[model samples]
Target: MTIWMRCFTGLQEVQKEQSDKLQDMKQFLAFIKKEFVHVIRDRRTLLILFGMPIMQILIFGFALSNEIKNSKIIIVDKADDVASRELISKIDASKYFEVSNERISESEIEPAFQKGKLKIVMVIPAQFNLDLHHSGVSQIQLIADASDPNTANLLVNYVSAIVKDYQSEISVPGIIPYRILPETRMLYNPQLKSAHNFVPGVMALVLMLVCVMMTAITIVREKETGTMEVLLVSPLRPWLVMVAKAVPYLVLSWVNVTTILILSVTVLNLPFNGSLLLLFAESTLFIITCLTLGIFISIMTNSQQVAMLISLMGMLLPTLLFSGFMFPLENMPEVLQWISNIIPARWYYVIVKDIMIKGLGFASLYKETLALVVITLFFFIISIKTFKQRLA
Candidate 1:
């Protein structure tokens, strides 16, 4: 009887243990379902989780490109002979230049450049064929807008190669070798210093990320911690409160700009050719633009993660792609190029390059400056309006 009773107690304990294990599993599954429901309910979270990857893949595959093609070129056919026409035909046939039909004089080239019509201008000297056939040598002058040094170099190289190919085709085996000497002149950036290009781009990227990302994150963090309500309910006006939040970041961004300039000048040996006052003034304007953009973003989103993701995916990608820094804007599709105009960094990049690299004053930068002002005001107004709406 005692043995049978002990066996019954052991069996009961084993069944109890099994029931406890089963209960734990049910609780775990229920917790998992609760988490899934929570995630599904947050639409922004879902979008970030799924939409971000698709957006990144599409942008990387389509928008980001380095190859330069279909550059506009102008040719002055001073020697309108058969040989000159043949050379022009070859240049026009190449995939690089989209030759203009409008015949422009050599004197009109500078004005055409000022109007940003063409990338390269080729001046074919008079008696080009006569010089080539009789003396076995002729000179072709290639004037490239070296504002973008990399593209200018590549364009010059492409033209030089075309000229060489033409010379080889016309050469007779037994006779004097025909040679077309290409005299290349790089305008704006004579030295072709890489720093001249990279410095302005870095300025745009750094200022943009610092001012936009930091300001957005700071304000969104306040909202996340519920301190934003406290500040809003305080005696201060909401716009003033938001401005107060931006002030520290604005000052910090200014210091950052100053530091970037100092380092660029001292370390990179880049010339500070433009007026320091003008550069600083423009930098302040850009900083204000970025800060206002951040404020707008913060008002739109409640989560720090979403704000950060938006800033990185939205701001960083566009700045890198559209600012004409990592890739040539001319190489992108027309739609992408059109989209680039709305990006504040694009104008700032141009402004910095003009002032810092090209040594231009406010006279040369008024258009870009005006663009920044308009963008700043747009963001500033919208941010204020959104903040008021959200608070109400």
Candidate 2:
């Protein structure tokens, strides 16, 4: 207790007094304006600041996922009989396989398989049904592409399940009744690949944190270093200077997004399954919302370190936790789930994932997209009011 008191007393004695109120206030604004101009000049920081969100989105969309689906198959039926026809019908009925090719000649099989046109090929011998009826056995060969284990396994299951169903229905009762089950198509990730499901959400969270932290720290740094005072005395309005500070970062962020997207598709082999334009549009709005959040953090913290800490701890935590990054919103407690409603990253994740992974159009994303826009507007209005109040 004595040691604690001594430390506290020494810290209080060493603390520097604040500058004169009116003069310092004016100088702070000038510094912010000058720092804003320097921010405009440094293009790389600008790019990372602005383009970070898009890069994160692409990284998350393409790099990570939990489900895989939609394998391709080929049918080569020599029998072309009723029983063989019944078997083919069953295979076609399954949603997991796309009938990408059909082959009759033995030579065509090598060519089609070599070209990667088929993941599996089903062959029904000419006398398959005749032999089954008489000998109680039929020969059907399933040639699977062994290169991709996941697709091959799923393809085998689908083909086997379909044929078993047909055999059971025609077989004597109490033996093994087989019936065609209802097709269970995956609504979002039809292919069921893990990358498509996770990348979108990952992208949202990464971009939000990077963009917000970069903007908030940069702004606060100006105030800490005494540059904000020079800019306030210049002719520019506070809002104009703020916008000027923010715009370059926004443009650079978009560029970074493009680079990340190229890497996602070319390097990571992830699919771009939605409108690029809509993706960019929503991304721009989301970036703006994040920048506003940074501005708010800057308003509260005089030190760049504090601004960075605030952005990371305050913004990143809520964005990751409430935005459904680690936990499913549906599975969360009602209170936490409801709280997620206000999280910008959560809304952006839904928008990006729904549009990019699900291939959903504007109509499908309207509600979520609108919520993001509304949130951005709310932040902008609040920050503007707060900034004005600080000046007054």
Candidate 3:
């Protein structure tokens, strides 16, 4: 009887332990379900977790490209002979060069460059065919705008290679009778220093991020923390409140621009050839444009997280892709090229390059300056409407 009682006690203890273990497992699963429900209910969280990755992959895959295509090139057929015509035909046939119909003369090249139209100008010297056939040597001049050094280098190389192929095809096998020499000239950046390209792009990226992201976050933080309503109820007008929010960021962004300029000149060995006054004025305009954009973003989004994500995903990608530093805008699809037109950073990048790298005057930059002004006014008007609505 005693042995049987002990066995029964042992069985009961095991059963009790098993019951406790099952209860714990159920609790764990219940907690997991509760957390899962919370995640699903928060749409923004779900979007960040799932939607952001998809968007990033798509953007990175499409926008992060370096293949050059359909770059505009002009051929000045000075020779107007069979060899020159044949060379022009070959260049036009290439997938890389889109032979422009702009009717460029040798004297008109500088003006065309100032207008930012032509990438390369190929000048076939007079009597190219006579020299090639009789003396076995002819020269082709390739003038490239080297403001964007990488593009200029690639273009020169492409033209040189094409000329070589043509020369080889027309040559006798053993005697090598035909020879064509490509004379390469880089216009703006003679040494082809990369700093000339990157400095301006970095300025655009830094200013856009600092002005837009910080301004949006500061305003959104007030709303998120429930202090914005308190301030709006105070003596200050709504527009004043918005202006007050934007002022500090504008000043700070200017400081950033100054710092970048100084560093570019001193550390990076970049030339500050344009007027300081002009550069400062342009920088201020660009900063205000970015600030207005940020305020507009703040007015649109309720939470700081959404504002941040939108600012980063929206502004950063466009800046990197359309600013024409990381990749050639010409290489991208036509739709993306059109989209680049709207990105404020693209204009700013061009302006900075003209001023700092090319030493161009306001005449060269007035169009870009006008673009920034238009963008600023656009965002400012919309932000005011939205802010007034919120106040009402």
Candidate of highest TM-score:
2
TM-score of 1: 0.57
What is the per-residue lDDT of model 1 for residues 179-254, given as tens digits with 9 covering 90 to 100?
A: 4555778777675555677678877887787678877887788799998888777654577656766776666567
lDDT of 2: 0.74
- 1-392 per-residue lDDT for model 2 (tens digits): 99999999877765532334555567556645665577768788767655665555555554543333456677788897889888776766676666654555655776777887578888888987898887878888888887988667767877887787787776766544564547678775566565654566656665676568877877777788887777677765677667656665576557656765666667556778889998998888888888888888887788988888888888888887888856779989899888999999898888878777667788888888888889888888888888889878
Q: Predictions ranked by TM-score, top down? A: 2, 1, 3
Give the lowest summed-lDDT range of ten residues in model 2.
61-70
Instruction: State the lDDT at 36 in candidate 3.
Output: 47
Question: What are the per-residue Cα lDDT tens digits for candidate 3 across 1-392?
Answer: 99999999999999999998897666555534543454457577445434433343334334543446788998888788998888888988998899887776889888888888678888888899999999988888889999999889999988888888888778877685554555678777776666677777777877787678877887888799998888777654566666666665566566667766766677656778888889889988988888898999999999989999999999988999898987889899999999898899999889888888778999888889898898889888888898879767
Lowest summed lDDT across 10 adjacent residues in model 1 is found at 52-61
The regions of model 3 sitting more than 4 angstroms off are 1-181
The collision pairs in model 3 are: none
* Model 2 C-alpha RMSD to native: 14.6
Error of 3 at 365 (Å): 1.6
TM-score of each: 0.57, 0.60, 0.57
Listing every candidate in turn, what is its Cα RMSD in Å to the true structure after a full C-alpha superposition?
18.2, 14.6, 19.1
Model 3, 332: alpha-carbon shift in Å?
2.3
Error of 2 at 254 (Å): 0.7
